[model samples]
Target: MQAPTRTARTAGVLFLLTFVSAITGAALYAPLLTDPDYIIGPGADTRILLGAVCELVLIITNIGTAVVLFPVLRHHSETAAVGYFAARIVECTFIAVGILSILAVVTLRQTAGPDAAEYLPVARALVAVHGWTFLLGPGFVVGIGNGLLLAFLMYRSHLVPRPMALLGLIGGPLMSMSGVAVLFGAYGQSSIPSALATLPEIIWEASLGIYLTVVGFRRPRDAETTGTGAQESRAPRS
Candidate 1:
């Protein structure tokens, strides 16, 4: 009913949308990601095109989450709040780059002649670029932005339950570390270890989204002491 409550719900919906778009995009991209010779074969351009659309949605929702939450989060810590917003921008940039790379692959497939050998290497190279972007953007930056920064803000402000915040606290570092491992060739990107590390951060975001959408932010009892002066001033003093 109130502006703040509306903002929380908007942010929650954005977060949930990010989840759906990201997963759908990734799943749709399987043909290119998993098949080395997909470019030479009868390409699934339609599927790839749909995947691109999903990722485009992901970019919008990703930034929306940060933008909607910035006002409330800044009340607790302006620096971190700004950092989260910036991180979201950076993540979206990576997502955009990845989208372009795959779309390029699709374009090449459409234009290539009967001699597909020449384009194979080029296609593979484009796929590689997308892979790196995926790792760096969602894999690395997400841990810092959503996992550590966002979680820390929620934890400090008690916007959500402490236990939910703890998931991010623990998951952020793990996800980042796993990304580094993948970057260094310690393990494959989709390895069990990487998935294990990513699990907590996923849970954290999902839980936060559901909680904010269903219940809205709970007014912190220690609002006066928590640096949320604006929120405290709005409350009636006994």
Candidate 2:
């Protein structure tokens, strides 16, 4: 009913949408991601195109979350809020590039026809670009933005439970370190260790989304007390 409540609900929905869109998009792209010679083979053009659509949804929801939350977050700390917003923009930018790369692959597949073999290297290169963007965008930038900055704000502002926020505090750095390790070839991106490392962050975000959607933001203790005091002061004289 109120503005803050509406804002929280909108942001929460956006967060959940981001999760859905991202996962669905990645799954839909499996044909390309798993197959190196997909460009030359009978490509799942329609499926791949659908995947690109999901990713476009992801980009929208990703930026929407930041935009919806910025006003509330800035009330707590303007600089951190701005940083988080910027981070979301950067993350979405990477996602957009990745989407374009995949689209290019699809285009080549459709138009290249029998000569697809010649563009095999080019298609693979494009896939590689998408892979790197995934790592850098969702892998690294998400750690800094959603994991650290957003979590810290939620923790400090008492917008959500501290324990929930704590998950982000811990997970953010772990996710970033894991990204770095993957970057340095400590393990493959799809390895068990990488999945394990990503678990906490996944939980943090999922829980935050659920909580904000269901319970909405909690008013700070001081704000509650101040409101009560103001009400008492305005009471009629005995």
Candidate 3:
């Protein structure tokens, strides 16, 4: 029997980061939307301040995790080498957007203080870009990109069990399309169609998190699932 590898472990950890960041990010938006009383008019209140801080953290951590995880997927995938790299490119976009988002809030403070409401339009654009690119964009990409790539490689190469491969296959497109919905700003409104569209995306991400953590943390059963992450070595032997 072959030993467990590092690939498994690395993917596992990446998976953990991916979902934890996602859930946190998604959860944060809820309070802001639900309770506008705290946000609409804010003094230097601790809770209000902390909420924004949490949002910034959520953006940073989520985007950061995405930036890191794509490479892990690329390193592991056998097909769609370009696609895997595209995933990285997409993630970098997310990071750029995340940074801009941080700057937007900081700038908001500066602007809101004086007669800088003129900058409101600029701030809105920046926040919109950040929202679409970093939070929603990468959120959509990571799940489908990695998940599909994993399934393809495992199925085509016979790396892992077929059931796992199937999950990747089914989940991948579902996730990718959901991500694309974000590109169109389907989540921008509170309408039923918009909510319905956004629901798939949230579910897609949540499912990805559950799948990766469950699969990643499991004890290695074969050389296919060894100690650290035997990415290529997991290919079946003749």
Q: What's the residue-level lDDT of 173 in candidate 1?
A: 80
Write candidate 1's Cα lDDT for 61-119 as tens digits: 99999989998899889999999999999999999999999999999888887877789
- Clashing residue pairs, backbone N/CA/C < 3 A, model 2: none
C-alpha TM-score for every candidate: 0.92, 0.91, 0.59
Worst 10 residues of 1 by lDDT: 220-229
lDDT (tens digit, per residue) of candidate 2 on 1-238: 1238889889899999999999999999999989999988888989999999999999989989998998889988999999999999999999999999999999988899788899999999999999999999999899989999999998877778788999999998899889999999999889999999988999999999998899888765433464533443566767
Off by over 4 Å in 3: 1-3, 26-82, 134-136, 179-238
Q: Report the C-alpha lDDT of model 3 over 60-124, residue by residue, as the tens digit.
A: 54444344444443444534645654664566567556555645554464446654455555555
| Collision pairs in model 1 | none
Rank the candidate models, highest lDDT first: 1, 2, 3
